[model samples]
Target chain A: MVLLFTAGCRAKVSESPIGPSVQLHAPLGLPPVPIPPDNPPTEATIALGKRLFYDIRLSKDNTLACATCHDPEHDFSDPHPISLGVGGAKGIRNAPTLINVAYQSSQFWDGRATSLEIQAASPIADPLEMNQTHKVSVSKLAKDPVYRKMFTDAFGSKDVTLGRVERSLASFERTILSGDSAFDRFQYGGQPTALTPAQARGLALFINPIKGNCAACHTITPQYALFTDGKFHNIGIGVNDDGTLKDAGRYHETTVKSDTGAFKTPTLRNIANTAPYMHDGSLQTLEQVVSFYAGQGNSNPYIDREIKTIHLDGQERSDLVEFLKSLTGKLPPNLEEEKSHP
Target chain B: MTRFYSRLWLCLPFALVITGCKSSPPPPTAAPAKPAVSYFKVDPATAGSVSGKITFSGRPPARKVIDMSEDPACVAAHKGKAMEESIIVGNKSGLENVFVYIKSGLEGKNFETPTATVVINQGGCQFHPHIIGVQVDQPVEITNSDPVTHNIHPMAEINREWNHSQGPGDPPMHRKFVKQEIMIPVKCNIHSWMHAYIGVLNHPYFTVSKEDGSFTIANLPPGTYTLATWQEKLGTQEQQVTVAPGGQAVINFTYKGRS
Candidate 1:
């Protein structure tokens, strides 16, 4: 992806791109991103990971790829309620947006995997997903002379292992982080005119504890504007009619009774473009999601304590959703146009 | 003439109440008693038991090594090598992880739900105990010790089927199986190789075979009962036996391997 630097925000960013260890430019007010010591981000590894991310051969039936579900045109998220996998098989949860995913502490809707590298292998072998075994995928890549050279360029040797595959994919995903937007310009860039009067008012209500209270989970600090706490909570989606959990959310992972129906809190960055919100994609529009919060979410026993009644009238609700729309920013450059595919 | 005067005196009180004078109502009568229900109680002194051993006649297959290259946390935990436990055979060709329980008899009995927690630990991307038995309504605590995330999904036939993802340091999950379904398969959706079986029963007379393939069910009242054994790969076996007061009934099962 192309990293464009504008004249207005150069003071807020510190970017340094080296050979095998590229230090990504942190947007204004954000902390330095953590990188694993062993799998340092080299330009070659990032390039290789980009190819694997978009290649359809990663799946058993070469019909689907990571890009098939996380389309760049849709802000790296599936527009459908659930992602469609091999043989038209459907996933159980909605595809989360990859924007600002580098800042996330955990991965997946339930936060089952801890890192992007680890999460890369799950969909490939999942029977209802890519259905391609890691062993077989590595052997397929080994036969190709181009992939073999690329592997040697990224790692010290050309020997292909499943670990290398995950590392490369993670490196590519780390480059997909988002930051710059109207909200960032207004808050961090010291641009007074970036947001409208309605948006400014909406931002106020969003942080007000008794008002929108959205900042409780989707934090909006002046230092960085990620608009997410990166924690999990159950906002009462996918709950059974009798108050029992239908999906069981984080509870399925932790076995904690209180975590029932809890899912990772996704970033509000570029949320307007990524419609069909929530873990289940049950809410079609941002306005609907705002309304759901206004009504204090669905009545479930395990609903997050922060999801209390927000007494917002119709006009206030619309203003809050408008503020969420201002989170849209420039997306990563399209990888399909790159001429590096093998 | 005297009896006629007495009857006239009794009618005079009612006649007076109709003339604007208030009178009190009659008192209520006692309700009829309900029939008592007979509940089955163990006579401890006369309780019997059924003990058995599960044996395999054929050669055990070589265990498969798990490939955890995708997640380094799991690989590091296992020190780069981990084996599958689909069919664990101990000494003397005894098979482990078999669910043994009393299938029939002891009707009209009410067994108290066990309050003790049954723990199933997930470490190195595999269940610590591949097989577990819990009485209906008994708490089962599922825990994860690895630094990575693991999702636990129980595919129960006669009970609620549910799935959840658990990350490292998260609190242990507590659940109860409310049905008497045996061999409810449990799997980790994240790691395909991670699997376990849970046996839920109405009575507490059930035990999973240890590493030696031996199991004993005590506190069985003196009666005729059908003992059942279940294995994931091998189907199941049932045997009828009668136990005398404080006597032990020996029932052994043998499974022949595929030739």
Candidate 2:
């Protein structure tokens, strides 16, 4: 929860702590993150949001907050495949990385949520997660004049509605775009020194529709680096641990049969940084992920018919993993260690 | 073939029992060869679109920390963003998305296809006209833009079950409801946020609110009928509206807080 501004922050960022910070340009290959015109990213908002991100005080028992499950050191992902809620309650789905989420169209694997403004408030009251109610959280924040002042400044007026929280959180999150990486340099920058031969081969197979068809959802564009199409697909990973036939995928939301076992195709931009891929977080390692794809997904009734086991060996898996590794980007510069919490 | 005839014969009695209004879009499914119904002549007149907005009555709920249910993929990815909070626009509308439409009585209106077809396009990765009301048994085209496949799944009790995928640049999906239904939940089998409401009324006397909270149902027959507004969390309310022949009737529905 450290919000320390390292020495590099003042030197690199164009705006120190003013209206909206335009220090880090949106990576070449993506649309400029569309911040809501009403609530632009103010330094105070970012600082407050960051504090909230790391503040365990938001929970009922003061055990967890957003950061307890999502760690910046681990590419903003909880190292555990699935996250544990308050009182060590085990959740059904694995924790997803918050990296490059500003580009996403909808929230959640099933696409049940349409906006970050809507998705942000789901966890606090989820019995299995924070196990806290919004009334209590707001009551606690009401006690803190600093938080109240920040909320009013960030969102005008002092009601401190949940919508503002979602928007502010979304605004802070909008800054977490992932683009600058070796793969980016090699592909967009045309720097031959960036990508290794094995990585280049892996990239080719990824985009080559006949080979990897990775472009089917994990799209790479000249405007944006290789992330994803922000669409859901059935990659054939099942979470039987939850006693689900195929996790119901997007079908659970829409009640459509074709969506029976589909899930959102997550961005592969931070693939190197985000371990344990897939909606269920079943796959542990990148090697295992590529191998799963090579093997055409886990066998299940609702398995996507497109899940065809193809030919891939250990070496190819390693090569693909190497290419994915090339996508690691420089961390958000000048991260201050969160003020040591009591 | 004999079995199909028997089923068709069984359906005939039902149609006769409740013969549709004079201008039914498609014939009653009494018999495929000689349906016991009338097809509404396609009208060349322009139809007005109705839209409005919904606001809350009290302080909306704060962001709830959502848990990643059984799916680890969702858990790992949404550790921070999940169940954060829902957007509460305007004052205090508890729930945002509300499916509002003429519940009944419109099922027998004379419905004729119009030259100007409403698209209800899927643009910017969201379903346009989040709440859509169309004449029952009319082809509502679902189109896609992003270079990926998206499946359209409509959960309705009255409509024939249909689920299909439209690829990028694929042909528009022409789906029709054979019967009248209301507040039919429409969602993309692909994305959860891609939600929509299809008001499948047999008549054209229905409309939805825009983001600013205003709506108008055009060409409504000059008559006093019950007008209703319903939000998801805030329940429903009804008001009587009267219109003269070829004259417009102005009606305003204000939710007394969450109605």
Candidate 3:
């Protein structure tokens, strides 16, 4: 029996030794989640990642967790315009929704990180955020017997490293996808009554290049709608009173003058849930965002030329907001937080 | 019999290592390696030429004035004369920036991927030549001459899509498309007004119409070919033309403006 077991273990060493792999449950209307080649998800990895994501031990003071800012009830985003970090330190930008983020070409408003794995490590080390080094964070996890077992089950070893932690966290995030909204059903699922008359009218105006032209950047394709072109643009946002950009945005990453005020076009999948619009999170509501665009986006020298002033009457404005609300979709199941170790 | 059974149990681990641990056959070796093809050379003695003019009929769309007020550098570069290049009509209704190429006829033939790189310069916050063509695997170099930064993004449908930021004084980016994709739309996310198109073909017989709406595809083996002209807004038109040995074929395409 020992020989048989040893033979089995040795035989599967080259294959998936971490048990069976699992597919992400992506709702309809969204494309398949683009998983990294090296970090294929398993049940063990996802469970470990979820525990790590919600654990306050990852922070310096053991007070802040990923879920503290990215609250699950609020569509995996922070309600505050700027997220409060460990020891009450405030972050520079709004906490973007984790829903459908796996589809994004790059991470963050500035797109400084190319992948979720790379983005996962930034907040843990940032002074204003978690304020914890990878070494300390790994040590915290390694000391816990439960975490040691979980890490062993997930990654085939009791030794915990930052790379495995990042891979696991990214794997869990890849599953927090949302899609199959009312707008998606109406547009792709051929459900005529999925949208109200006002929303239908708004959809028409949204696509009309001369009218709303909202789809110019918040794109919708014939097949599926990711609602983002995955490109940065300065739409007159964050312009100060002195006619200069308050936030350099993409410019800081690329050191390009034209990208001075530009920021990534965030996905609009669950736009209603993740409020306080734009990269700065200044706009309080969808109406203000729409109105800002209607006024041709705060006219700075670096503003996108696509932002032409448009006339949206009272009725049109309300309908456009209604259409945006229809974008709120169903969240993935099994997001309930597990009790943390005392 | 007991000795034989003990020996069989010991050999089971090696059998599992041989069969169970083996990888899945390497994906059929990617369509059998493709037969080695020789480079096609144009026989100058029997080579033909296809010269054509792309003309616009009716009223052309008025070029919208580009507002570069936001970027002081772009405004200074164009001297406030920057306009949309979607529709550039020359004298006598000659339509510029139309891509003309042989759509069909030279098949199963391989052409040398041009060693000379096709340059697309970003000057004054706009793509210098709005429309371009290149053979498959031909190098397409993008250079930024503007004082500002420009992110070049190619939204290719059939080919791989890529987006990169290129700042002034940065080295030119070299890229090539392995697949034949027609009219890949390129955009600058930084400057939303900046747009360009690239057409990739397997053969070397392709050219963009000049400012006077003239295009000439020289060095073509004499044969009947289905020629096509593509205008960004006006759509595409196709025509069949037969070229006599060493003869010049004249073909003109007319695109009507939207009524």
DockQ of 1: 0.01
TM-score of chain B of 3: 0.84
Task: Order the numbered candidates by TM-score, best leading.
Answer: 3, 1, 2
Candidate order by decreasing lDDT: 3, 1, 2
- Candidate 3 segments exceeding 4 Å error: A1-17, A340-342, B1-259
Runs in model 2 deviating more than 4 A are: A1-24, A157-159, A239-246, A334-337, A340-342, B1-259
Question: How large a fraction of the reference contact set does each model reproduce?
Answer: 0.00, 0.00, 0.00
What would the per-residue lDDT of candidate 2 be over residues B160-236, giving only the tens digit for each residue? 54444444465575556667676677665544555666776665555555434555555443445677776544567
Per-residue lDDT of B5 in model 1: 19
lDDT of 1 by residue, A1-342 (tens): 111222233234222212558886666545676787766788888888888888888899888788777877788888998888899898788888888777788899889999888897788888888889886687777778878788877875666667778888888888776667787888888997898988888888899999999999998775776677878899867654334767987888999998888998899988998887888877777766775676555556788999875566546767898899888887656444367546
| Residue B46 lDDT, candidate 3, scale 0-100 | 88
For candidate 3, report its TM-score. 0.55
Lowest lDDT 10-mer window, candidate 1 chain A? A1-10
TM-score (chain B only), all candidates: 0.82, 0.62, 0.84
lDDT at A106, model 2: 85
